[model samples]
Target: MFRSSRGLYSHIPCPVLPRCRLPHCLFNHGQQHQTKQPRQAVPQRQISNSASTAGSSVYAGKGRVSSSLLIGQSEINEHVSLAFKGSAKRDAPATESTVPSATPTKRARQQVSVPLESKRSADAAANFTAAEDEAKDSAVVYILPVKPHPPALHSQRLQLATALAKALRDNKLSTTPNNAASTKELEIASRTTSATYANTMKQHIISLGKRGKSVEKINAKKTNEIPSERILEYIPQLVHKEWQLEENKYLTALPSQNEIEEARAAVASGYETCDRCTRHFKVGAEGQSECVHHWGKPYRVKGSDKKFSCCGEMEGMTAGCRTSPRHVFRITHYPRLAVMIPFRQATATGNNFPSAVALDCEMGYTTLGSELIRLTILEFPSNNVLYDSLVKPIGEVIDLNTQYSGVTSVEDPGIPTFDATMNTVLAKYIGAQTILIGHGLENDLAVMRLYHKKVIDTSILFPLDNPGLTSRGYKRSLKSLAFSMLQRDIQGTSRSSTVTRSTTEGVISNEGASCASTLPPSVVAPDALKLEGHDSIEDAKAAADLVALRVKFMLALEDQKRAGATTELKIAT
Candidate 1:
């Protein structure tokens, strides 16, 4: 289960106000907001959208989510903005009545705040007229100028110095006659005293003009809640120790079915990595059968340090309180994989060898391991379905893995059996030259007993940089990717109780399910599989589209770089 962070890093930096040294800051007041990483190419920023969804497999980008500790989710960030136009005169304080609770008359006259873009006033600032411009509609605060103003400046140090300086300059100069010698000498002495006062005033003015940034920095540290930016800054180092690294020596980037089979026979015999707990165990171990896990992804609640599991439990409070009848293991070793009845690689007969392909599968817990229940494949670029079907699994049916998968039944008389379907249906569309696409297909490929050399995994393509959450690492959900990249929402929504049939779009199969959606607050039995299912066809198309979008972004970035270089060369000449 997972969601991506649009908080901290997603908010646009405050607009520069040229000389914004006001007692009351118009921009980020108390928070220590940092600008996002500067992109060399503007479109790279758009990658944030496409990051979750990009990849290719005839059917790829599984949105099947389980109690995965490697995939993380967090609250979407909301931008906060406060702006004021500089309409005050060169220098004069407002009357005491003008300010809500100013201590003295001097403070009232000097503190002037012009509202930012008010239709009611003809002189509103045009800088932030549009609410949704770059700031994404930073919470618009509409404070009327006629209303009583709150005490603006909080830093006592600046206030005291400012008031003292104003008093010295405004009052008439008076000297004691006892201190002066001759009239001429007194005049020279008076001039020297005046310069000293002028210099001191200048120094205080400079310090006060710095917009209280130093004071704000101190205030930020005292804040009780952690800032979103601080959370983002620490994300990279938060990768879970159990999470597999991209360069893990235990497995190759692309291991073939044969290699995995050999490993199963030699070293990792009867061993499996549980999809729920991420613990390795012998398939038949006594204690291994029971799995205590959350059926949903973990998320960080906004404004609170408290983290929560999607299943409605405080994160880290317990080691997955919900117990499953069977500790379903994700098939990584090939020998233990379920053999699916093929609809036949009927499309393989065609001479056309697709360059790109996306794939997705649905699965159920079986005696042998997780078995493939449904498979969907789509051709790249065109998004034509090369193959799609429901298959009978190899083991005795246990739980259908439906809480995350959303698949309710295979008992419909229309469901096809091994004998009814033709074999080699997948071999037809995917060939040596074809590049397979999916999101986190490692587990899926093992179920298919395939270790394709040419593969484009969305999890690898657009990894979640944040690893601070318990359920996150490099991999993210297809739903997150689709929403981020394609700007379209998919999965669960399309597959309702009325639509569970031979196939659907955005569904995760038994093999490598990657659903990000979570179960409801209530827990359901494993056998129930009551959750809404996903569509492989929908995810497949998204994977292909994700890859295509990435390619286009890269090309555009290169073109922009070239244009910039050429312009610079002309100027140098």
Candidate 2:
């Protein structure tokens, strides 16, 4: 049966299965019989090289089977049927093998054999072309160039003045009019008339000369005709009855002891005072309060045997151990003679006068040393001119100090006398309750011989304290305060021009005198000369403006405090 099966299978022309051996011939026959035909073409190159050997073996085995098989009709019939089926399968594989062999494998071989460099070059070229196409399709942009503006034309007079100054400085000309040629040259270059130019030049020269000299020399020269000491007997008596009447009419009443004590108490309570050191401590709480007085310590030099005493008086042989209290007081603590001055409130009358006023005074050298030459007062809120006047000195005129006083010539018929300025100009605007504000107000008040209780001094407001030094009353300049706090530039313009002209006009108008008697020079001239001195009116207005700014800042701070307090109260509730 096995021989018959092998003979039948070999004659059936099955695919060369060399792996099928006689030891497992039955399994091989069964597998071959069960195998399905392939659906696709099997290329001749894809077939194994062992196929030919297997095919030869199969044919040899078939020959053996044919030779060994017993001759019978049934067996012949079975072999014929099986050979027919095998021929059908062999025909299909033959057709497929022939189809692949006819065509060349050139396309497949080329795909596998391409060089790496050629592929990389092709890929790079494609990428670059694509990038170029994208760039061409994008939009173009252009930037426009900017043109610069032309320079502006400034003041011609200022330019000429500057040139003249430069020329004088270069020539090393002594600022005194003693050099007539230099003065004339400067005047001509400055484009000013001889008379006007001469006066300005002479003043400038004298100022420069005086600055170079000692204070004693300058004072001696200014007061050459007058005595160094106060000559009370030499002072001329008030011959005019109007002056006496004016003084009597404008005299302010003194404050009582009760008001003074109340003011002191208020200051002690720490209102409006610098509490930088004491603010952290509970003022009156036990074990928390700090001393208000400034203390001084004894010091000994590096190699000295003796020790320096404290500021306080020395007790026995040793230096005083206790700290000394300074006699410092705020402006608010000062007692005012005027009663019931309104605090930043307008008066009941329709006069529209401000509650506070800022004052500035200019002094000229006289037999009594420096005396008030001009006084200017400005209303606080409105900054309106309350009082502006040129006052004749109480004693014999020594020097006008026009370089600083801004009083070029004090011969105006409309200018008020010292008595009239105090009574009519100042008294008309200021009340007992009015708060007086200024820089270095004590000096101004002393020169004016006026006693004002409610005062606001910028010097006191912003003290220039040098903690290392023992000096306590160091005051800051009004210019510095205005520049730093108010962001304003003041006292730059010459006071002689603006102040003198305005003051003369104001005095004339106040006294109802003819305008002709106090007419100012060309308005343009004063504007041009504004570079020359300090204007009392301008100074007063500047001080007032500073105070107003301070008031606004204080109000803003108060508002913030109130808002914070209200928020805290709401949370507490």
State the C-alpha lDDT per candidate: 0.44, 0.42
Listed in order, each prediction's TM-score against the native is 0.43, 0.35
Residues 1-573, candidate 2, lDDT per residue (tens digit)? Answer: 254444544445335464443432433354554565343534443233212221111121112112111121232223333432333234323444343332336543222112211232233233333443222211111110001110111132233333434333333232211122222332333344434644564565455444433322323233323331222111112011232212223223444678766765654543332222223332223443323432233455567543434344332343234321211111322252112121221123334444567789987755443577777776665555555667776555645655566566565565667776666644466665566778877667656767555566666445443312312334567878878866766666433222222444333121221122333221111211223457676577667666655444434444555878999999999
Estimate the Cα RMSD of every predicted model relative to the unseen true structure: 28.5, 39.8
Error of 2 at 237 (Å): 42
The TM-score of candidate 1 is 0.43
Q: What is the lDDT of residue 216 in candidate 2?
A: 21
lDDT of 1: 0.44
Q: Please, what are the lDDT tens digits per residue for candidate 1 over residues 1-573?
A: 122243442244446543333333334423432333223432332222222211110011222112111111110111111121122222123343343332223332223222211211222223223321222211111221111221121132223333433332222111111111111121222233433534543454455444233322333223323433442233223221222323221123344467545655664566666788777667666765577887777776887554544557777778886788666665444343322211111224344666566788777887566777776676655565566666666666767776556666666554555443324444556665456677766656556655454556666556543323312444578989899868867676335323321132333233222222321211111232343657666667777677665554433444555878999999999
C-alpha-based local distance difference test score of model 2: 0.42
